[model samples]
Target: MMRAADLPGVIPVFPLPGALLLPRARLPLHLFEPRYLAMLDDVLKTPHRLIGMVQPDPNPRAAQEDAPPPLHSIGCAGRVTQFSETEDGRYMITLAGISRFRVTEEVGGFCPYRRVKPSWEGFDRDLARSEKDTGFKRESFLDLLSRYFQAKSLDTDWETLKEADDEMLINSLSMLLSFDPEEKQALLEAPSLSTRRETLVTLIEYALRGGDDHGLLQ
Candidate 1:
């Protein structure tokens, strides 16, 4: 029930790898590190308890470093809707994605994790409009994904996939696909569900044509 206009537009940050949070999606996090545990504490006490979810680059050594990655300029801001403290001092929290935010500036010294002032001019406005399937493009996108998986011999539950809702299909594919960081960011920043759907179709087609020339499907 928090008002968007009243949000501080800034809050403490938690960076987790392989996590892509989209507007309207929910992310469950296990908070263990001292820095992030303190972050959970501060979030629980704040009026606008939002956290920016961004992934670190693909490096085991880099991930173990004490600092967060240089985050992509754009990320989704999600409010801590569910929280629980375990007996072992860890935290289980779920963030309900609210809006897309731009990192305006970083604030230091709150905790080991960083904080940022966000710009949320076009947060979740897409929710007001009905999402329309772009017809042939979507089907083609699914076909490409299917063929790519087959070509790579990856096992997936096609029956379950076929029954997924539009949002579920698009977001799950976007998350599950081995897209590069820049491409993934593009999907994150796409203004509308339709826009993201189109981008996914394009990326899939590119992968189909071997334009990526990498082991994306594998």
Candidate 2:
């Protein structure tokens, strides 16, 4: 058992450009960049393993990036469980979700990745395990999602989607969908699974209507 204050919440974080990790789920990452490879080594050298996952604000026009993109306020802390180094000097790793964290402060570190002090006060255990069945509407919801994916020419496995647990289904789709930054932030900040589900349903409905708007995915 780890206490909030003793857990070193103010630690280095690597921002993944297009991934979202929900509590109790796992995220596999391929790390090739020098900065992130160093970050992985540093985290592996410690016992309290945790890092944040966030998407970079898309900038297709930038000729050269001056620095890493600004991260969103809300992110889930993931524990490094499995890691391997490739012959080409890349890291293949898996992160198991721990909890959602709110960034309190950012600090410059030895590595290029950003560090954050998280507010872990009042973190609830029940909220993390509260994955419930979606009941009758689940099939219909999935059907709508399939249609939307086909129209957009997105690749997804309907069979795997059906077998995925609640967190996997919700978080995976949320990360892949073409939701705007504001909406993505809202889903990241949503307090619980049910709330995230509600937001997802609304977003799916809006998308099915052929609207490319911010509110659809937020």
Candidate 3:
């Protein structure tokens, strides 16, 4: 029952280096570290129960020792749709992607996890559940994906790939693949579903052709 307006202007961000969560896709996260455990607790208290998934600075050189690395400006906020606690004091949670956000600024807080003001501009379409990309050539895209997987000796359930809708197929691959953080960011910031698909194709092809030692797992 949450609307776009129901989302908060400021949200807690989990600055994971390569994690990507696209709109309407679900990302599974294991929470063990103390700060994140605290973050989940506070998030659950909110009606939206959302968390922002972001990447650290793409340049490793920019990070100093022990201090938090500067975060990339664009990130996706997802509502916590599932949660479970283990006997070992760990947590398992699933974030259901809601919208992509721009980090306007970091909010100073007493809380241990970082908080930021998120702007949801230019992402109204993400609020809609079904986004169509008529230009998607499933047969051809799958052909390229098959090559990439084969080159990397990776295995996937082909039937599942065939069954998912276009957005699910593309977004899941973009989030789950081990492309470098920069490539992941490109996919996250893609203006639309079709654009994200194209970026993914380029990354996979570049990897297959040995583009860089680590240009982008990615």
lDDT winner between 1 and 2, please give it: 1
Q: What would the per-residue lDDT of candidate 2 be over residues 23-56, giving only the tens digit for each residue?
A: 7777888999887887887888888777777655
**Which candidate do you rate higher for lDDT, 1 or 3?**
3
Reference-based TM-score, model 3: 0.93
Q: Which runs of model 1 end up more than 4 angstroms from their true locations? A: 1-3, 55-69, 84-87, 124-130, 134-138, 209-218
- Look at candidate 1 and tell me the lDDT of residue 40: 79
Tens digit per residue, CA lDDT, model 1, 6-63: 5675777666655678766777889899889877777779877788886544544444
Q: Estimate each model's TM-score.
A: 0.76, 0.79, 0.93
- The most accurate candidate by TM-score is 3
Each model's lDDT: 0.72, 0.72, 0.89
Q: By TM-score, rank the candidates, best first.
A: 3, 2, 1
lDDT of 1 at 96: 82
Where is model 3 more than 4 Å wrong at Cα? Answer: 60-67, 216-218
Error of 1 at 42 (Å): 1.3
| Number of backbone-clashing residue pairs for each candidate, in the order shown | 0, 1, 6
lDDT (Cα, tens digit) per residue for candidate 3, span 83-145? 999999999999999999999988985889999999998899889876878899999989999
